[model samples]
Target: MKNSVFFVLVNILLCACGASANAPSEAEVFSSAHTTPNVLMIVIDDLGWSDVGYNQTTDLLETPNIDALAQQSLSFDNAYAGAANCAPSRAVLMSGQYGPRHGVYTVSPSARGNAKARKLIPIKNQRGLKTQVITMGEALKSAGYATGTFGKWHLGADPDKQGFDKNVAGSHQGMTFHYFSPYNLPNIKDGPKGEYLTDRLTTEVINWIKTPKDSPFFAYLPYYTVHTPLQAPEQVIEKYRKKGIKGEDAKYAAMVELMDTNVGRILTMLQAEGLSDDTLVIFTSDNGGYRTTSFPTPIRAGKGSYYEGGLRVPLLISWPGKIKPGLDHTPVINADFYPTLLTLGKAEQPNQALDGVDLTDLLLNQQAINSRDLFWHFPVYLQAHHARTDQGQDPLFRTRPGSAIRSGDWKLIQYFENNEFELYNLANDLAENNNLASQKPNKVAELKAKLKAWQQQTGADIPTELNPEYDADINQKMIDKILAKKTHH
Candidate 1:
């Protein structure tokens, strides 16, 4: 886990400043047959439920290929991105716990990793995911799986440093600015000329699968599609433009169409390679799509906000001959994926704390979990670049820290710093437009206590150094390394 941060830091630095001029090559490929089942996790960025045809929106944005894939998948109707936004959500997703547990409560553009630097003023007071935490890749690798990550490696950036055997074209930046020929500031690998980013990523996956390996493979393809810069090929945009759409809506629609097409290509490769039946393909987005381009009408709030739209994301799992195809309102959170995958693959978990439950039995046996609570903590919203801020900030120019506790139909959203709260019965009100807290004071109190207890258990708090460590030793080492290289030249 400590090594994970180095990779993340490298990637973040690359995304923040561009890829390294001479970034190291991917590590040697490992065999995959020794592992139980190969896993392909396709995570789309900022995609909305309405964007996919399976979700049934009136917008008529067709996603035939994705829809077909979903038909055979265990669709999750109430899945959520662990956090309202990306980085923090990914921290939770990777650690199989809430962000607070990992000390990654929110996205930190300046998060650190080097130990020599850690000895100095310290790495920001903001909680970081400790090296002690376990990641899905590390766990699988320990179990003899070949893990490869392609596209958008935003959990600190360096996938190889984290645990991947092979990594191609991922960075800390949310999405590559150039779709056709993508490059990060840190490790710029130019894509084949005219090759779109989405198609290129899928191509890399297909190639990885073709590698002659004996161990099971874990391919984490976090697509940078349908996120931002909303650029698609002219042909794609024209395909929708000729259909009577224009401006922002048309561009957004084109991006969605392209995203679906690329996903289909991956599915086609799986079928062609005869790996579909043996592989477990999980498709989900990090968070809801941007509100301006996508509609989450039935669900209030969009990305960066605590409302359903920000956190609610589409989830589908397809393990042929394993999971039965159908919709399940079984309220499982992102953390559930951790244990669920381990259980499904029959892999051993490390001796450590894990917040996610294995939902494999639920998916395969049609069993119920009875009652389980899902939690989310967002300490701050710092410089949100991808999503829009709905209004001018409060007098403090910052949003307050907030936490949520959800069990069954009841959900309580609490803003800790401001002492504001909202409660909703999702079974009755999916939009979350009505605040039931005032009407259900007792329920609010009960949930507040639960949320507080969980916080105590997790021990999540902004450390004293988070505010003052701009020139911390870690960043200094990064600077010194850069300068030393220049002087040597």
Candidate 2:
């Protein structure tokens, strides 16, 4: 009887051990056992879709580090920026709302170009992001993450006021006056004489990541390289010049390479600190490239224009073992990142409604997200960079007050100036060279109805009142001058 009792006791103990093994621990339940990943988002300023070597569109530019990252990441071919330009695009990403929701449609004043060229009174623009809106940093920080932003924060004057625990060199300023040290930026102090801005920003992020912490971190490194005032290291520029790429093109190429090199450094540090597998790395551009400097070919116009070139950008998401590396052609925008990161970090949704969809399934299992129409509303005017080569509707302006929607493969752009519609079948013509509005009335009607409904839903303002300063003759003369110059060239 004693021997039988001993065997029974052993059986009970074994069962208890098995039960403990099957049940999840407290750390596992909360995902605090390093299961909750770190987020490192690197945003490049004015980098084009075809600038990277993985795209194989440009032979002049070299980006080995970015190309390597692309090989191990889920590259998005149809990813787009929230807006065509800098300030508005950054606002959309931060707020996870459309331009209409935040009332930040363009940079500075809504009136751009000559007053006589603007037909309608454009909507008033908001210079900075309102503090009331919840930012990604705040959302992640609320979920027990250490949030830090190490670069441009064009949304507001202070990033710390908005969800970030640490802000390096971010401010309301759109672009840096100089890429070298003595940047004159409010937050950052002067470094050595020739210290580059991109390099300094990357170093700051690396140092921030190195700090000991109990919780995971969200490192937002928005490098201000590859933008205007085209300056690069002389040696790197010389290297490009030797390859027959001289002048501004050589300087641009050098800037791109330097940015890629910094990205490599970050990747190396993550591995060194044993944070590679525990981190989710995202690399993308704020908008499309500057037209004259890095024109995205076969995609049409760049920067301010709402063409494929201006909206489309390179996107790569890498999570060592968690996310499988491959190419995803699904159409996505920067605003989508807001909900996606929140979901991945297990953060609660804010009180305000989010316009973007959560991409967790798409990021993890390679499953496709629900089909939805993408919209862009610009109730403001943006003048052309180079009227002759901007490839916009007209030479005078890159974009008039307009609203655009992309439903499936069809894209419709409605201009408030003329109440006119320009439609294109993107699947067949990615360049947006052919307008099928005249040929397919049913398709145009369908898209227009959808766009109209979206406009009403989003409360997108449509400028209708005519501008008192608009002069038809003056606009015509400017157009004529641009045309004459193009013809002469």
Regions of candidate 1 where Cα sits further than 4 Å from its true position: 1-35, 109-130, 185-188, 382-399, 462-489
How would you encode candidate 2's per-residue C-alpha lDDT over 1-489 as one tens digit per residue?
Answer: 222343356557667787666554422322222257799999998898898889857698889999999999999999999999999988888889988898988888899999999999999998878999998889999999999998888989999999998998999978888998888886788899989998999899999999999998999988888888898889999999999997999999999999999999999998898888789999999888877878787898888878888899999999765577889989999999999998889899998878888998788766689999999999999998888788888888888899999898889999998888999988989999998889989998999999999899989888999999999999989899988998999
- Report backbone clashes per prediction: 28, 0
Q: Which stretches of candidate 2 lie over 4 Å from their true place?
A: 1-34
Error of 2 at 384 (Å): 1.2
**Global lDDT of model 2:** 0.88
What is the overall TM-score of model 1 with all chains considered together?
0.81
The lDDT for every candidate, in the order shown, is: 0.72, 0.88
**Cα lDDT tens digits for candidate 1, 1-489:** 222344466567657766556543232011112225689999888888667888965755878888999999989998988887677777777888877666665556333333232222222323344566778888888888899988877766576777688988755665677777744434446766777878777888888888989888999988888777878888878888888888877888888888888889888888887788678889998887776777776776566666787788889998765567889887777888888878766778867778888886677666677678888876553332222332112211123356788877998988643367889999889887688888999999999999989988987653233334334555456655655654676
Q: For all the candidates, what are their Cα RMSDs to the real structure?
A: 16.0, 7.0
Per-candidate TM-scores read 0.81, 0.92
